[model samples]
Target: MAARSVLVAGGGIAGTAAALGLHKAGYDVTVVEAHPDTAEDIGAFLTLASNGMRALAELDATDAVTAVGFPLTVLRLLDDRGTEMAHGPLGAADDPALRYRCLLRGELNAALQAEAVRRGILLRHGARLTSVTDAPDGVTAHFADGTTLTAALLVGADGLNSTVRRTAVAPRTQPRYAGQHVYYGYTDGHTHAATDGPPTPPDTRAITMVRGSGAAFGYAVSPAGRTYWFARVAGDPLPVGGPGHRTARALLPLLRKDPTPAAGIVEACAGPVMVTNATEMPLGTPWHTGRVLLIGDAAHAASPATGQGASMALEDAVVLAKALRDSPDPHTAFARYEHHRRPRVEHNITVSGALSRGTRTTPADRGDDDTLTAQLAWDTPLPAAPGEHA
Candidate 1:
């Protein structure tokens, strides 16, 4: 019942994962990326939670994941002077069976991308989706390079500013700017950024939250043992956009205060620091069209604070591919995909928003602190494991 072919627009973690999943289901898949090329260094650290690991497991790439990433066993919260306020195990330290697998975004991306290539998935870089036409038989994607191809279904797995999203759906409005901004980058490890000072405090693989009265900073150690830091200040992305250096100059006025870990990390960024934007996709309505469907950031952009953006996207790929494998007709498959994924995706969007909005408090103090239940439902089971969900 799988579709004959699928076209996944965008080559990021979401799009490539979808392409690989669909291809493994016996459907011919092609992935089109707007980026001209790819590199080993993506320049950002990512926390996988338990949910992300289960997704990678489905691809049977956990070994590769283990090679590059680390396990998160505990979370520590500290104040400006390195005073511990809250500390807890990441549910894994207590039970070694529990897996809160965390890794670098680049490392995971490389694993997924390599698996996709090994499976004969057609990978294209520098191919921008210009338009999409869903016909009675199949969907066709028109690219900026004056080329076109047809497939049984099309997936708009593109991220924010997604061209696929704009052409296929109701064309959701520009993302509303989140009121705060951040500066994030990766370090070789937990090396102190304060002019070669002592190690930073409350450091762990668990996603660390350095909270304050009106603002907060959230960050953690990535899989590669390199530290990742983000300082969330009350502002928006700097207007000037060229490179990270220029943006940092403009944001200097906005990020003057050293609030806890934010102050420490900012001094340590050592490399180029860019202004970060906190924005949300209004939850694009009608996430589907004739033969086109949306997934990942194109359908809904999860706030980084919730840390479920990648998890939800991976789930979308699994659910959508399962629907296609179960239904005979592409339309029926598309319908089933929407029916099963709609509620879950919407709730996640809301949860991510609420988490970001309430960042100034500890997880227990936050009104919408349902991280425990949220984690279980979101994590997909590892196929190799006898019994596991997330």
Candidate 2:
């Protein structure tokens, strides 16, 4: 039989990862990205927990990713006064290989995209998917540029506001605001020890969490002497507002009130602060219809607080490819994919939601759930990709 051709939409992490996996599974794959430049370094750095790194290894992209990122293992929690509240090791603590990682979002995307291209996958930029028509044997994707491609399967790896998801898979599925707004600003020439007094810890890989009144700040110093910091505040989700600098200015007062290094970091960052509301998709949304399927944020977007968004997306791509390679049809493959993923995704939603709420409210106000949070962070097992070694 001739190799099956698959069309993957949105060339971000999930899309590129899916292309690689499908090609490895003996299927022809082409990726269409609406954005003209996939190389642009946009957005703040993100955390790729142990599970996500393992998934990248399955695609043979771990070496490339690790080359450009830092390995993180310890997370320190502190109060607004910079006093240590509690400190713990990330992951199982015993398994050193499962160390947490922090990397620039753009670098990770670039690495994944480069890996896809290196494997001879065709990637088309500036092609926005307008609609998708499904047939019993195949699916036809119509691009906004008056171009169309027919393939045996259509995979929506687009992010939260996915066009493929809105047009074909589940029109009614929407991203709901999680009642928190976030800001991330990167500083150049500014050290993490911006605050006066004792110098910050020598360890650069620790993720420091500082809790203020109804708000939280997190900063991780990169090996390059740059500090990646973020602030989460309770706010309205709609009518997105301001450039990064302006947003940073607006949130400065709150940070000034905070007695941690956050105030200094925010004050030192250059222009362009990323401001957006935290959001997540409702669980139980259908992930596929006919020959079309949704992966990543299209199917389930988790709050960034969970730190599992990227990991979940990477997992989705690998598992979906496995199901397609093993099952006889698209429906069965998508069903199997969802069956194996929904429980964990939903569980993360709850875990992340509670954590996010805790940031906006007091920990005591949020109730005692440290045990649940710890289990979700360290004990929950991510499913292994097809062909991944145990």
Candidate 3:
């Protein structure tokens, strides 16, 4: 039998992972990305929980990911004064190798894209989807490049502002601003002077979270003496040409007032600072309809407070591909994918909102808790996809 042809929209984490997974399941997969280059990582660092590592392992890309990333052991919560408040374990307890992995968002995307290309999956750059039309049996995607492709299935792995979501899924479905924003940048530890206090152990790789009056800071040392840091502050959505465009030096003063070492991190930053409005898609009932399906941020976007946004996208890709590999029909497969993933994604969404709210208050008022770490860890094993053997 001829393999089913799948046209995936978006070439980010979810899109690339889905392309790889579907190809592994005996389907011909092609990914279309709007960006001129899909391999470039556009965001900051992100933690891949144990579950996400397992999903990458299933796709045979874990080692590639770990090669460029660092392993994080514990997540430490502190106050504005850098006083220890609470700590919690990261990753699944049973597997030491599966502990949380942190890497540049670009590196992760590059690794995944390399792996997918090596597996013979086709990826087309600069092919933005202009619109999508559903037919009786398949869906036709119209691209801005004046190209059209029809396939057995179309996967909307595009991101929060997914064009496929608007054209294929419910046109009414939309993403809402979560009323929080984050500033992130990276700096080289080797280039900066260490704080005068007691030096942390060389082997220490714990992620530190410090709660300020109305903001929160998180940072961890990555491999090669690099510091990855982010600061979350409560504010209305940024207006056009707002402080986000301010120079690193300009923003440093605002963040330095906090008692934590955010000032030091800012002073050491060697790259451009990024400010993003944290947003979440209002939970919609059914993530799919007919021959077209949505996955990743396109379907259900969540705040980064829970740190499961990337992991959830990985999980969604694997499950959706598995559903296609196992189910007797496309409709059935889409239904199964939505059913299995909705509960978990929804839970993350709720918990993320709660944590985001907590960031608005002082850490002392929040009290000592491992809520973030617990929410970040995925203890249960993901159900094996059809092609993956137990």
Candidate 4:
């Protein structure tokens, strides 16, 4: 029998990783992306925890990603008084391939896309998805440029504000503000001095988080001496159509209230300080209908507080692929995938949202690591859905 053709919408981290997984499962996968090129949102950076790395390992694409990003081995926490409160090794720090990695969002997307292309998967840039038509036999994707493609399955890996989810899956569901405004920027550490002391070099391999009086701040220095920093402040959502480019000075007042290094890092930023409202999808939103299914942010997007957005999406790719590869049919695959993923991703959404809203004081315990390891293991057979035979 001919391999089933699959259509994947959006070509960012989630979409590309899903394409890799589906192709590996013997599906004829084609990816459609609205962006004209791979280099979009280059300024935004994120950390992929060890679990995300393990997912990449299952897809055999670990080297492609680790090549571009620097590993973070240690996590340090500081109080509002600039005093160190806790320090420890980051997730799986001893395992080079599974260590936490900090990467620019665009670079990571490009790396995954490149790996998919290298594996002979069809990837089309500038292919904007306008709507989806799900028929009994197959699903059809209509593009903005007056083109269409039909396939046995449609996977929506688009980020927040996914077209597939809005038009097809659940029309009423919308992303909600998670009670915080996120700001991030980069500064040349070589040119900036600490607020309380002379020019001190940054800890290259350590990511420092500050519990400031004004905002929650984090920073990681690259090996090249550039400081990548972000601050999340609890506030009303930025007014729609407000200024996109904010000055670092506007945020300095908040940072200065605490004696931490956040203020100095913002002050030294020579470029525009980028700001975005932390947002998340509503819990229990539908993820599939007929031949169409949603993955990544389209299905479950949590706030940035836990720093697990990309990692969660990577996990989605691996699990979804395993479900399809092992299940008897696509419907069973979708059901089993959701059964396995909903609990974990929803837990993240709840915890991260609480952290963003200041409703949670301490970090909640993430469920068993061993179970997740087995779930993402490519060779391990995915467990059957409730009411299904083993």
TM-score of decoy 1: 0.81
Candidate ranking under lDDT, highest first, comes to: 4, 2, 3, 1
Clashes of 3: 1
- Give one digit per residue, the lDDT tens place, for model 2 in 1-390: 133889999898889989987887778999999888765446677888777766666666777787777777788887877678877776634544446778888888888888888999999899988999988878999988799999988899888898888889788878888878888877766545535446565467688888876467887777877778888887676474542334477778887775677787788887778877888888787888998898888888877776788887877777677777776477667776777778777777777766776643332111113432322231233343454332
TM per candidate: 0.81, 0.87, 0.86, 0.97
Number of the candidate with higher lDDT, 1 or 2: 2
- Candidate 3 residues lying further than 4 Å off, grouped into runs, are 1-3, 39-43, 93-96, 190-204, 240-246, 249-254, 359-390
Q: Show the colliding residue pairs in model 1.
A: 193-268
List runs of model 2 lying over 4 Å from the truth.
1-3, 92-97, 191-196, 238-247, 359-390
Greater-lDDT candidate between 3 and 4: 4
Q: In model 4, which runs have C-alpha deviations exceeding 4 angstroms? A: 1-3, 190-194, 197-199, 365-368
lDDT, candidate 1, 1-390, per-residue tens:
135888899887788888867776678898988777654236656666555556556655556666666677777675654455888876435533336656656677777777788888999888878888878778889988899988888889888777777876757555655555555665554544332246554355576666544446666775445667666656445564622432334433333343344454554455775555666777646678788888888877756666677777776776676666666466666766676666666676666566566643333222113442332232332122112112
What are the per-residue Cα lDDT tens digits for candidate 4 across 81-197? Answer: 888899999889999999999989999999999999999999999998999999888899999889998999999998899999988899899999999989888888543344675
Q: Write the per-residue lDDT of candidate 3 for residues 1-390, one digit (tens) a residue.
A: 123989999888998988887887789888988888744545578888777776776666777777878888787887766577888776563565567888878888888888888888988889989999988778899998788988878999889888888887778877877767877777786332234345554334688877765567778886677778787767687775563433366556556666566677788777687787788988763477777899998988987877788887887777776777776378778766776778778877767766776632321111112432222223422343344332
lDDT of 4: 0.89
- How high is the lDDT of residue 232 in model 1? 61
Ten contiguous residues minimizing lDDT sum, candidate 2 = 360-369
